[model samples]
Target: MNSLYWGEGGRFGPFDEQEDGWPNAGQVMRYFREKSNLSAETFALLYSKELEKAGKQNKRGQVTATWILNMEKQNLIPLDMERRRIIARLLHIPPVLLGLATLEAVTIQSRKKKPMGTLQKVTIDLAKHQKSIRDALHIHRTSSAKNLMQDVERDIWTLKDIEAQVRGDLLYQIQELLLSNFLLATRIMKDQRNYPAAYRSANEAVRVARQTQDNDLIATALYTRGCIKAEWARRGTVFNGMFQLDTGKMKSAAKDFQGVLQLEQETSIHPQLAGFTRLQLSRALAMLKLGPRDAKVAQALTMVDDAADAIDADPVEDFYIRALITGTLTGLHAGGYHLGRSETLNAAGLPGQALAELNQVRQLRQGKTYSGDETRYQAWFDLLMSETYMNLGDYPEATARAKNALVTFHQIHSPRNMASIKDIQSRLALSSYGTSIDVKELNDMLQEWYKPE
Candidate 1:
């Protein structure tokens, strides 16, 4: 089977096609409609009724089967804003797909209907406000700040109102704002350990981006969704005692990442974003827990290395990307030793050597400023240190590090890490004091925290 046609019926199939000579808007619309089992005349009738609801008088005067046919043939352009919107709604397609020029004309007409500042000015203000919220999230590692949450919520409401008044080219900008808000919401909810709400926000971001027909935004939305799914999977393991791989969620995330990579290849835009997508793809693969000797694990390691190289070569200098790639490389290298070499080292009683590998992870983070989810990396480092101390027969140090790890995990609301820390602490207590301690109480506490309020 051709790799190109692999998983053709999957959720990401729409994004798998080669880059060159992509179909135009009309071709895309026609293909989707036909695939939906709708006849041209049937679609035309529904579209005509939609136009009528938008105050387009006389279906025969505005549109007909012939007009629909011409539109599908790319011979007719729906330059009218009302008609464009109605057609988009009826066909369940983005108005931007109609054409950039058509979308720009619609944007200009929509701006004329606004009572306030110019479109450019309003767009700039919204972008700045969104950026401020994003910066706050990065600096604080949360959206829990009262004033900031209030501002973000207020901005969301304002965006909804603005969305109702804008379409076409400006619709992309509005969708970008919606994506930002929802992405932020997703992160905030995730930080709060509210997986369901995080997933909801991510889904909304994808929906909004789809309406803009912007592949970059759509890819970003997919990435956000994938991250949320992966987090949920991680939480499930931590809270539910399901140690087996969450294959379903990991597969879904891989599909999303693959879709992003396909889109990037097609568009040739945002090379750094593509690198990030590849990094994420590597993560999803790693989470499968394929044995270190497995071919898939080797492939995933290669992907991690290749992604880091690509990011290093990106002309656009992004500190966040640099930090992320560095941290990822460090983690992957540590994980390789933990999964493969550590077993042999432990068997040989050369635990100190294993400790050295884990210590390298900490050294890599020195003087680095991580832009996103810094707590996660910190908690991971603490966990690694705790394990290393345990291996070295320093039970007291191991217990202390485990307790410290628990604090960091608690701050991040990471149930899985907390559970792992509790287990480590229990082991250290038993080994050093000859007192067997049950972690059931700690596990129960985590269960309560996992419960939705």
Candidate 2:
């Protein structure tokens, strides 16, 4: 065996004697390309002409592939915003991922001591961008929302350098901008399933909002944090079979929701916001796994009814708000209220009434335009239908609905719902065949769906 030097004082013989050092951007690019089984020549051939047509040709008229080699070897590093943007687009990654400033950041950096009037204009523009981002989210255009948030993040970072130079209303404007950025970042992070990052961003939003003493902004931040906690708690539950609650996490989530409600009561902002908060609190309470007769469950149902009436009376006209209310109502009818009623009826030997309540949820879901809400609503609807059919002894329909729910859950990237559907399928199989079915194959499939990137 040949010896080669590895890290400090570590060696294998001659074969391993190749140089070891930190790879530059170019080297990293080459390494990744080669690892992907792409030859430099082939990679160049693929993108060179496009780069040339895009006018990214170097002084020697070499294309982007040549530039990549130059970048790898530390001979050239593109600093122009256009070049960086082109490269990032070609690579399908952010410019920051390539250790380059985004175009927005670069533009902001080029400005020196921007006038307050200009900043005010910028603030207004940023607010408009935020609204656009919200619109994207409303339409379930997650990638667009994320890209907009990233732009906002870059602009905020660029402004931070000049924070001390600004004063008075300008400083306040800057603070509000920072607050919005953090809050938006929190939302995008949560959507992407990066819960920890979302929580951190929400906390930052709260800190900044508190500095401004803005009750609305603070409430928004608190509401966001509370939602994150509730989701985390929900994910912690053993979702297979019946919903087995994780009491500790559920309690923590309940406390977060209660805190938000308390803040709202103290400050008294938008009545709709209060309704929204109460809706979430109701959801948390409903999912506590208490029996139907539990006072808490009844209270949760009351909260849901109250929130729904409030939301309907005010009419927010926001897609997400409407979807959320619809979703919550579906949940309340399917499991929170109706499911509890069904369980109680089943326990009382009244299977027919139990099935009727479950069917009511299906009726409610019908004739509603799901649109962008398809994945979520479909999963819930199908799962509830499956359970209802099973209770009614309609095994075939139960099996089909369970499978459909599984597929919908997969589409939505919901491991918990997938697990629940699998459980239901297993129960259906056992009921029909007098033997439990093996779910090893389904488990393997779900493992692939949830595998860490």
Candidate 3:
């Protein structure tokens, strides 16, 4: 396969810390500064001035220009993790990238034609890199974090931290990390169009939560698992870029939600958590009504109403729970809209409601009050809003919302979202009217329904 296609230029070489020296965060700072066309001393001056503005003196109550330079040279500045993260953000580089002592290089090479029965070589190289990363992760898992080399040390440390805290006071941290990983894996699988993997990861998250002995963790995991199950059922575990709906997946999702509800009944979990989980379950079941069964749809609607009642009984200041509810509600709205149930639209205000929910999400982000999973959950809401507006024949609105979603999507590195937005833009471009679907747009979407695998 490697012979079938060309590879990129670059050699895979070791990143030597002692030889190359620790990464000068300041050098990176300088790189971003140059990229932004700012003076080298601008940031240093800004920091100094900001210190003065805060009624504090510089290191010697003097100019910080040389001090900044010294810090850059020694790679000893950015005294705090948050500060380092901020600098990384300002520089438009990943925090992880900045710590890299040496970059792994890959160079593309031209393909040479061979005899018949040969596969492409380019694909092989790409596979090799992916396998390498996965293999590294596996190896790191078996070793102690302190014993591991720097390259794998960070991941090893985090994994060990998660493991060490899973049964202790840091159980919350474990649940949070597992939840984030589960969500990340879910998005990845969805992007690769691999539903089975997404479902498996989601289930694994639930299992981890159970081990944590945290009711909040357990319930939240179940809620998220239900969502993934619903998504799989709605879209089918198989995909070919078509929107062919699958009822079996929805039923499976519904079953998962039921499992959540059953657990809620048995455990003394937080009321808010239980309420939110039941709400999610209702949303999953609601999706099942997309079939011709009117009775089932009615029952699903009642379940949703019942969940809503329960939510009203729960506390409102719980930001995490609110984030979860918003997500589940958005899903319900989407499922209802697709099922051609007028009542679904009436019961839910379509994407318009989702847009309002995103405002709350924005508040959550600004407040810096949410954990990583909640942040991603809010981001998903933003994506939902963009998609909803797009579906309602509002191209400009859709495009703007899509752009916001793209920013968050890139941060999270979800390929599935990137692809979905690309398809949406293409549809918008081919439409005669900028807003609203004409016959052509409808035809294009329908074509997607029958796209080949």
Ranking by lDDT: 1, 2, 3
Model 2: per-residue Cα lDDT over 278-362, one tens digit each: 7677767766635666676667657755654443344446543332222222222223345444443443334576678666655
Per-candidate TM equals: 0.55, 0.53, 0.43
Per-residue alpha-carbon lDDT of candidate 3 for residues 308-378, written as tens digits (9 for 90 to 100): 44433443453333333332222222222222222233224344544544454445432233334443444
Score residue 38 of candidate 3 by CA lDDT.
60
User: Which regions of candidate 3 are displaced past 4 Å?
Assistant: 1-195, 207-218, 234-242, 291-293, 305-382, 426-453
Could you list the CA RMSD of all candidates, in the order they appear?
A: 15.0, 20.0, 19.4
Worst 10 residues of 2 by lDDT: 9-18
Q: In model 2, which regions exceed 4 Å deviation?
A: 1-124, 135-188, 237-244, 289-294, 318-369, 372-375, 383-399, 412-453
Per-residue error (Å), model 3, residue 444: 17
Question: So what's the TM-score on candidate 1?
Answer: 0.55
